[model samples]
Target: MMQTFLDLKAKQPEDLPSIIKIAFGLAAFFPPVKSEIRLDFFDDQLNEVQKEAVSFALEATDLALIHGPPGTGKTQTLIEIIRQLAARDLKILVCGPSNISVDNIADKLGPFRIPMVRIGHPARLLPSVISTSLDVAIKYSSGGMLVNDIRKEMDEKLNTSKKTRNGTERRKLWEDIRDLRKECKVRERRCTEDIVRASKVVLSTLHGAGGRDIIRQNFDVVIIDEAGQALEAQSLIPLVRGPSKCILAGDHLQLPPTIPRTDKTSSLRKLELSLFERIIKLHGPLIKRTLSVQYRMHEMIMKYPSIGLYDSLLLADVSVRSHLLSDLPNVIKTDETQEPLVFWDTNPHGGFGEDDTGAHESKSNAMEAALCRYHLRNLLEAGVQPKDIAIITPYNAQVALLSGLIKSEFPDEFSEIEIGSVDGFQGREKEAILLSLVRSNEKKEVGFLADERRLNGICLLQNSHFLGTVP
Candidate 1:
């Protein structure tokens, strides 16, 4: 694919979009081109910054960026941009760094009545988006119905072939089945192509965008969500399709693209820098807009990170200023002050000391695991549903320990709660988060916890309350 892009650039530069040329350093980077097009706002609930982002996305001719702080309604703003672009009859391709990110955008757009289709394996898709997946969409198309009919006939023939006694008759049946299967394959491909051509929007993960079905289609606009988490090369896969306009939205302050720890080469280190971050650094405010107001975290929970990470620019909406677990009816307060943020010291003298002895060199503290289980039981007993809570740790060993502890204690009741690494919880939110910072020793070495980006992700994983077991 990279070779193809290079070939096009060398021989057919005019056919390539300006955005692609600028990204590859083939052309001088220019500021956003102002458009005379005026659009009526589709969503009245948009904040002033969100509205500005939507307008800037529409006006920028080559490239645009949106720096969405945690819970600032970045996905909502992206949906409006897509809607307005589609209103102008432009075909748009929406790509994300991961499957969950793409599904999130699709889930929100599902209610907008847009003709969009998600491209990826059905099994990887969330349940809410399965209905809009390529396979499901094809199944309901006219051609899909034809393929189903052929498949039904093939199934009947195979069943008969299995029961037939005569060898000649059975061979004939098998041959007929083979021919029917071939026909089904041809029809399914055509059906897939038809769906891709008719849809106004195509959604896929960055690598999935390179699939043959999507590569053949043209997009007028390309929008990448969570762009800060995608590698530069990964982000280019969809942009190489020659979209005239491009928009990248994500919080560069959060977790960056995961680079293997063993890869200390300078080249690999450079690749860790995402395209979204690179562009903003090179162009400053000219090509980007920051979404200043957040709607997800409580004010008290949002206070520290807002001042520390966002330079005091992030603000919690009035509706969630005092959001707390105790505010829910029949819930028990875990602390007298009912503070949204609570820290339990897990040092050697405090709660529990960390150890890698039985964890295969990955960090895990039994004391923290036991504390996490205690908190889960408290929330469940106080009326919090298992689905509204999540446990986040920075190590896989700690994740496994927490899962085992939760299962042994509740068995079936707490099975719905999610337990995973901080990286796994990006672009996700829950009512409450139980964090285990599994690092403690005599020297007080912090290890990978020193990555501020990872800490940024940990800070945004909860909506109302946060509980941490710190070393």
Candidate 2:
């Protein structure tokens, strides 16, 4: 095995691609193989069916969707694509509905040497790779960032207190307040650093962005994992930004965003009267791609969902078989007491269900209450950990009493309550999910979720608008 630089140089041209791939993975640094590389998927041993699906995605012009049941290796398939593309030196931007997805990708992209840069925020890692900028890394990442402006406000309020309480108790309280203020400032700094320098593959809570914005940031390729659970509108924001290639991944059968509303209308429906009233924006065919062969689930479980794209059922007798619906009861239920799941995607409507109005409906709320009890009690009987169970509701006020009821009956079995609709559950996983459809009379309330002017939306819209109207 005598080999010299000259010998290596003389190697076959075909072997060059192989050597380059190996070096790219091992090298400390190297130039990109192509000016840019965008591939919908990357896998060597895909079955003929899966390969065809991946091809459909790559050939698409506007958007590509890859979907299936959970734990079907959808995430891993994406990672495999990144690995293959990285071998060709592609620069990728990965964004998901939550930080968890972002972190998962980072972990798979292990040992990153160069820091991610130039997207949003300042240049520089808030925390060093080894240490998150203490002033950064993770903080009140939740909005309104929970800092005690109270401390500063209190200090201002007491400025006129010339006769300070002379008691030691008063002195101690003042000192404690000062300490608390110091802590808040310190933690705020950490949170800032966390968000700023976390990584280029940011896992953010999709707080209203558009496709045009993502492309504007110069992403050569973008992969949105869990795309179906997202509204076609929200997910398309990144596409509008103009990434040369984009992949939308998620099961369309899952949840989408929730637009708030109340009294007589839902948040999204109210918004439709306001924003989309002008023109509806992004849709999937407008984009170009999709991945459909699910690698998880038994042969039977895959049969029902496949019926959407395929006419007949397909299953294998192999070990990694798809679990069919008829067999799912016994297959998915590993434990003897596994609970039942209730799901409703019914419509809300008027004029023969043509309109989607989320106004207080007796049927919707009643169904929600019943489904809530069914799933919560099922989990209780199954003895699933309380935190492992989640009942996702479409409204905030929608599930308070339901949660209270669950707490009353099976306080120890179903303690983790998630309210406020589908979007809120993004990037989270539960042993199982029982979705309560609050707006199914079929007007398509999902689209109105992105309208910018919906009052019943985020900030206390009603109070602010009606403040002066009150006596």
Q: Estimate each model's TM-score.
A: 0.87, 0.46
User: What lDDT does candidate 1 reach at residue 457?
Assistant: 85
At residue 73, give the lDDT of candidate 2: 50
* Candidate 1, RMSD to the unseen true structure: 3.5
lDDT of 2 at 260: 45
Displacement of residue 160 (Cα, Å) in model 1 is 10
Residue 395: error of model 1 in Å? 1.1
Q: Using lDDT as the measure, which candidate wins?
A: 1
In model 2, how large is the Cα lDDT of residue 54?
A: 54
Per-residue alpha-carbon lDDT of candidate 1 for residues 262-361, written as tens digits (9 for 90 to 100): 6355467777789898887766777888898888888888877788888998888888788888787777776622668888888877748887564236
